[model samples]
Target: MRLNNKTKAGYFNFLGTLVIMLFIFGVGAFLLEYFVYDYFGWAQWLFLIIPIGCITLFYARGRQIFEYDSDGEALNFKNRNVVLFLDKHLSDEFPKYKLLKYDVVNIIILKRLYVSISSKKSHNITLRYDISYLTKKELNDLKFSLSKVIKNNKERKREPSS
Candidate 1:
């Protein structure tokens, strides 16, 4: 599925982050004054710089595009800086790696989350990453392609290994 991060979601994410940061600071400042009995009025506001700066960086980083291709069996991530392939089916081969793919196989669709593929060896959450906003066509195509992979895998018989 070819998709880029949604500009609207990034903006909303920035605002939401700003609001949460403000709330956290407000609470921290209030607690400091009440317990410490120090009347450091307005001085506590300096900490606001931390959240503003961090959110600004995060929002800027979110602009990079991410793409996925089930037919090609690869996902372009890290702001398209790196390519992740989908062919390495675990089948419980590497327990450590499966631990991570537990969350890597999900994508967003129509503002809803869906797991395009998952492992029987891992217990992953349905809700996952927020990047990769997709078109209806792309989403449908990815779903269809993933379903075929899942069906084929399920139909294959297991063999005893040495």
Candidate 2:
């Protein structure tokens, strides 16, 4: 899915916040050096490194796409390989098909986002992704595609036995 400017803005916002915090701490350290003591100067530099490292790591990880086939199997993200196994079964009260019922539920829009998918077997899967670099349209499309995949898998599993 293509990422939009909104998502990019979100990432920038996070990075911006981190930079601002580091700057503030650096300023405080400078003041301390002038008025209090120079012993804590290293702390300011160390604090600044953390935010920079985080920003670099975020960019390096790149984007992630999740795709599930009609047979209730998920496509391996890294290798684009098909995984022909089920990790765990949902509980009795909630069936596996329940995951297909929702259009979208519990979506948090931010740098780090969390989504919840409830299965019919009384179990739920929580998907966590970074959306700070995606646009609103891209995010919506991704969600829709995921829902459709889940629905298709559910239907496939319900076919009558021969």
Candidate 3:
């Protein structure tokens, strides 16, 4: 199965633009109120908080695009921030048979997928991907896909190689 949240990238970009516009509007309102009224009103606090709150929320939830491909013999994963230069791009690919286990952490503001794969050096390497932008249905599908791979790996190990 190949899964990607590419469609949501545009939505996130739109939201970012909206947030910036709101911040600009808020600043204009703040300046107007200060210059015309000569005193800060109670509503002024909301203008200040609006942009800060939006920034905090987006930062906590992350702004990365996550793609997972279980096609062919290897599982591929790619995660990169919407703002390309803001963060380094991350990509990982490994054979499906080496996948030992996987876990999805879903907290109120944080969502992440952790995959553990057996490495050639007799150690397990864990890869993490931000899944905050994924919808609940998408998240469930991802979990199901990972579980299927892990089950197959376990079953393959149980069978003796002739």
Candidate 4:
């Protein structure tokens, strides 16, 4: 899926909050240092800098785009990808029935909190992400693309039977 500029801005804003928090804390630390450590040593300043540095690095690394594919594969921001194979317990519980294909599941946007995809067979998957990053148009387009992929896959499956 294509990430629009608004998504990028949302990521930046998420990280920006951390930077702002660090700046505020740093200022507070400086004031504390002057009041309590002026006659002592520079140890407090060192302690404060360490946490701020760590927080900045953590946020910088966390900002990225996420991609999910039709086959329940998830590609994270770090470029790591994994296929979500159904577990044996789930498979046994939800035995596949004719005309009910788990792989035919498509993405569904629910309210403002959750995104779910469910197959005709009842197998389902859901993800919770910061959707506030997406504009209405971008979200609509993404949903359309995902739906099309799912529909195509279903069509391919039916073609073998025909």
Off by over 4 Å in 3: 31-43
Report how far off residue 151 is in candidate 3 (Å): 0.5
Clashes of each: 0, 11, 0, 0
Would you estimate the TM-scores of all the predictions? 0.32, 0.38, 0.88, 0.35
lDDT of candidates 1 onward, in order: 0.43, 0.46, 0.86, 0.44
Q: Candidate 1 clashing pairs? A: none
Instruction: TM-score winner between 3 and 4, please give it.
Output: 3
lDDT, candidate 1, 17-84, per-residue tens: 57567767866766677568667666655555565665455443332233444334443322321112
After TM-score superposition, what is the CA distance of residue 37 in candidate 2 from its true location, in Å?
Answer: 17
Q: Pick the candidate with the highest TM-score.
A: 3
Please state the error at residue 30 of candidate 1 in Å: 26
Off by over 4 Å in 4: 4-124
Q: lDDT per residue, candidate 3, 28-132, as tens digits?
A: 878788678747678777776888788678867864699999999999999887877767888999999999998888898889899999988999999888999
By lDDT, who's the top model here? 3
**Global CA lDDT of candidate 3, please?**
0.86
RMSD of each candidate? Answer: 11.0, 10.4, 1.9, 11.1
Which 10 consecutive positions of candidate 4 have the poorest summed lDDT?
Answer: 86-95
lDDT of 4 by residue, 94-122 (tens): 11121122222223422222344455677
Residue lDDT tens for model 2, 1-162:
222343244455566567557667756656667567667655646655665566556444334222322233432111111111312211112223444333332334234444455755877766544444455665577667556766776777898879
The runs of at least 3 residues in candidate 2 whose Cα sits more than 4 Å from the true structure, single-residue gaps closed, are: 1-73, 76-125
- Decide which is better by TM-score, 1 or 2: 2
